[model samples]
Target: MTQYHFISGLPRAGSTLLSALLRQNPAVRAGIVSPVGSLVAAVLKDMGPDNETSLFLDEAQRAALLRGLFDSYYGALPPGTAVFDTNRGWTGRLDLLARLFPDCRVICCVRPVPWIIDSVERLIRRNVFEVSKIFGSDVGGTAYSRAELMMAPSGLIGFPLNAMKQAMHGDHSARLLLLPYDTLAEHPQETLAAVYEFCGLPPFKHDVDDIAFDAGEFDARLGTPGLHAVRPQARREVRETILPPDLWARWEGASVWRDPAFHRRVAVGGTPGADHGTAAG
Candidate 1:
């Protein structure tokens, strides 16, 4: 009986690293972001009340159809294994997700806003020879300008933060578990321990230092090689600041997790919701 779960949150916030480590568990299947969530959304809208086909199905039928779609998508995996669906949009659709799978848990991987912005900028600068397929060839501007474009209210990297914030305040927040990027990079055992427990799974050994993931296909298409590369050990990148001093200062005080209310207290088998593994609702 395969169970469903979600992995999402801020971009460059270690979700990729987390996924790599998660796949270490033989009973767990996780990978790069999947299109299932988007497909679910499309199916729902198309079968919504306005659609003629919707009238043929009642509440139970609709529910069964949606659930079946997931089963069919992940049907190739071995039985009795838990499925983790990765997508930044999951944080934005907590309510819908909860209603769809009452027992499902959402694991959000997050990091400081300033650092998240800095990471993307660093990637852009490193790949000077190759135009980033993510930002497109016309990333035409200074490092600071590019940062602004990526952090603005409607920026590509900015939307996930806002969406996660909204879910934190939403009614279904109890199903969410927040994993700070630093924690996973610095202390993976404890981080993954809490995740497994929250999702109602028994303990399984995870070789944090023996992790590996090859994102060659998507990375090449995105024009951002090594985007999902993970080192064997969990360690933070140590290097000089690529962004200018003034530019760095722009996002100096953007660590939302620093707030007393957002403090993470995830221990083994930690409960979900605002005060525990989840963000305040």
Candidate 2:
């Protein structure tokens, strides 16, 4: 049987890089975000009580159908391959995942909220000629306004952050492995070892110096080229904030995951004393 796992959490937080590193393992198959998570949600909606056809669908049927989605979508992979599906939505659907694949684990890539906004703004500036879909139809706005939109409850960065928070506090929190972008970039080999241990997978040497991954076409569609690109080297680049002083101050201490209490609840990369929880990252 094929073992399945997940890569989720905030945007621009090294998920693409993590996937790239993981892909180096011959037994593992991972990539940029996939459609399976959304497809699973669609399937559930159709089978839900709101649908007239749902009256005929029993629990067993629903379970089987949901399981089949993974089977079908990844059918092309060689049997026994470990599949790590990347999707920010998965963190919010842990209950469904627990039911469908109890052995599955979710790795949540995270960064300070301020930096997340800063990163998005940097991308917007880089693609000066292109108005990103990230801001929706109202792309004409100041950095402050764009930051507000991105921090709205349903906004790109906001939603994933909320979902990850919920997962961290939920019953299935142990199934999550929190991988901070800085930790992953600064100490990739050690980070990968923790990830392997969390997923119950045997260790495989990964090349951190020459990693490669990109989703240029996918990013272009969103008008944000290079959103999913990974650098050839996995190392942290220290830089000053591009955000204005006031903006930087506003979100400076917003990294709740850095709190000692939060660390006590979920496993954090490079933190040996962390809980280590009971499941995947």
Candidate 3:
């Protein structure tokens, strides 16, 4: 069977950056954000609306449907080439993925908790999503508006962290790789080597283009003066509201879905110090 790899993490948790870095390697062929398998199954569910019950389906039925979708989506990859799929939905389902594709490799991308929350706030101000709330959230998931619904834990990148923990404990634990967001930003080559080794791919040796932080790109704003700023710990406060009620609901409820590590940790497999990797020089 062909090998497949997934790069999963909370939104704004360096997923895109890692994907870009991985694509720079000659041994890999990453795909665009075409969530082929999951999207197809979801569309299938919508076809016969009356028979579709999102919450009522049993685990077996859901799994079967998902497996079919996976087959349809992944069966098309060109032979012998490894495909890196950077989708958040696969975070919790890594184990299931192993069952579906025994040769699959999973990478769990992590950052500090505070950084993720701050990123969400910035996205809200930029009108990325019409809502500020995330479902199953501790602070933002209160009874309010549309932004809540869209940002609801269920909607805001619904990859369950609990599922990730369970997968980590399962038989496929060796196949799963955890990556730090900060390290990838500061030393991408070292991080990329670990990923390549675990996936059974050839070593990577290339300098990637670095995009420095640009405030003007997102039209960022600072924190609120005194009131609504302190408690939520807003990083980029907004002058005017940007989130819609439904979207806010989803964003708010989506808090638990977040990985607690928003920043780099000390003893996470690799050394904390900046140990450089020579890219085949």
Candidate 4:
């Protein structure tokens, strides 16, 4: 049987890198955001009261249909392969997932909110000639406006962050393993070992220094060329902030997972010591 797990959390965090590294394990299958989550959502919507034909369906039928989506999508994989479906929406759908795959776990990659914004800004600046679809149809906007847009409740960064926070405080929090971006970048080996342990899988040697991943076509469609690209080496690159000081200050301490109280509520990976002190920037 194929084991199913999930990868979710804030954008611009280390999900792309995590996926790249996980793929190094021959028994694992992972990649950039998959459409499976959205398909699951569509199936649920179609089975909801809003749909005229939904009244004919029972809980068992609905569950079977949902499970079939995964089986069909990954049917070609060998029976024992572990499939890590990447989607930010997964955090919010834990209730449904619990019913579908009780033993599955979600690995949420997170980072300081300010740095997330800065990373997106950096990408926008690097691709100056192309107006990113990240901003929708708006072709022009200042840094502040762009920040405000992304910080909206349903915006790219906002939705996943909110979903993660909700999951952290909810009943399914135990199924989540929060991995900080800084820790993964700075300590790839230790992070991967922890991830394997969390998933109950035996460890596999990974060539972290030669990690490779890119989603050029997907990124091109978004008008953001390198959105899902991962550098060959897995190491943190220190750089000065490109955001204005005031903008940086606005979001600097917004990483909720860094809070001591957060560790008390759920399991966290990559932090040093038993107390789970703040992760390095």
Candidate 5:
């Protein structure tokens, strides 16, 4: 059986960053999203009058479509390597992933609700046009409201996140690791050590002794291609401006960010792997 680590979370909770870090380890092969599925769905749009794609595709065709998606992703990965895919709102389809890889370790990354909302708001302000260029008609005709997107019936971000939490509370806790974003921000090495253990990977030695994790501008040199490229300044703006002051209270009591040590890191530049959470969902 292949070992797979599923980085499941709401958008803007640092799934990209976490996936990038995990991918750096030689044992892991990260699977990022491709535009092929959406692209294919769009070209077939004219074929249907209403939302009747199901009528076009027979049972075998439907199965083939899903298979193409899986194959497109898995075919790129090296044999015997653990695969990691960091997609938001992936918890709802947990069983689907389980069937794909029987041995799976899920890392459900989470941030405070307020911060996540704020990040979504920022993404709406800046990235909508850029994202739409790729997703195009698949994203819907008119622009979507961030609030409505968050509370969508399909569980866009918040509710699905809560569902993940509930799963952790149930029988899945042994396989599901609830990693707070704040915890990672403060002590990346320590937190990542725990994650590596959970994923059954050998821990790498920590080189930086006095390093602090800062979500500020990352190293321009450590180019991990598309995964590491995120707008941290935009993230900070949303965290400071968009999220209401009231919401901070909910996370302020938590041990990671609320505690003095973590606060100190936030006040100063944090450690080696410091990451800024972006507004994306």
Candidate 6:
């Protein structure tokens, strides 16, 4: 089995920054999001029980094939480097993934739902000249309207948030860790400590003050240029939200996942990440 993990959580919640920082470890190989998860899901469906080819394949062969796909994708990497694949799609496939890799874990990088919305909204406004790649460049509306669209049941922001909530309530919840945005943005040392503890690897000293990552080619194609870029110095919060007061109020009560009590009830890591531990419910 390959040494691999996943970095998936809410959009605009620091997954890119986290990946950039962690890869500073010479033993770790991580970067922007990968399409491996999507490809695997598609292949598995085609090879499922209904497929005519299924008759020729046994469970062992299927497992080997799946593992082969992963190893093949990362074949160019050095033999001993650990891999961390970033994708929101992983959240929806936690059960399937657990069956495939018993020891591997899915790290969910999360933030407050409202703040998550705000961050995405700010991005939308910043790229006013170009449409976002999230909604297929077809998205157009006022800030509130776009926010509403983003929070739609199937949207980029909404779906992952919902999926993560389900994972929290699932039996494999302990296999998932809710790494808060504040923890990564503010106290990266402690945050990475917890990650190393979970992954059973010794901690690597990350240059938090001089961190640098830029997925320029990918972001340019994504129509959201600078989407995954990180500055040299780390900062606590993104710029202030651009949404009006009323629209912002609507999301204030949506961050139930931020509560310590909720973490105690759901997250494997029972500590609420930030010192500000307040819950809507």
TM-score of 3: 0.58
> In the order shown, what is each candidate's alpha-carbon RMSD?
5.1, 5.0, 11.3, 3.0, 10.0, 3.2
Worst 10 residues of 3 by lDDT: 225-234
User: In candidate 5, what are the lDDT values of residues 49-99, reduced to their tens digit?
Assistant: 665655767645644665466566567666667766555544555654555
Per-residue alpha-carbon lDDT of candidate 6 for residues 163-274, written as tens digits (9 for 90 to 100):
8878777877777888777777777877787888888777788888988787888887888877787878666753555657687688776565766555423333444535
What are the clashing pairs of model 5?
212-270, 212-271, 213-270, 213-271, 214-274, 215-275
**Candidate 6 lDDT score relative to the true structure:** 0.75
- Candidate 5 or 2, higher lDDT: 2
Candidate 6 colliding pairs: none
Q: For model 4, what is the error of residue 94's alpha carbon versus the real structure, in angstroms, after optimal superposition? A: 0.9
Candidate 2 vs candidate 3: the TM-score winner is: 2
Candidates' TM-scores? 0.87, 0.93, 0.58, 0.94, 0.57, 0.89
| Candidate 4 per-residue C-alpha lDDT over 1-281 given as tens digits, one digit per residue, 9 for 90 to 100 | 99999999999888999999999999999998898998998888888889999989988999999999999999999989999999999999988888999889899988778778888988998998897999995789987889889988999888998998888888988888988887888788988898888888889989998987879999999999999989999988777677888887776666777776765344344362222123233
Error of 4 at 82 (Å): 0.5
Candidate no. 1 TM-score: 0.87
Task: Judge candidate 3 at residue 226 and give its lDDT.
Answer: 15
Better of 1 and 3 by TM-score: 1
Could you say which candidate leads in lDDT?
4
How accurate locally, in lDDT, is each candidate? 0.76, 0.85, 0.52, 0.85, 0.51, 0.75
Task: List, residue by residue over 41-111, the lDDT tens digit for candidate 3.
Answer: 47546544467565566666766776666556767666676778766667566666776677788777664
Better TM-score candidate (3, 4)? 4
Error of 4 at 95 (Å): 1.2
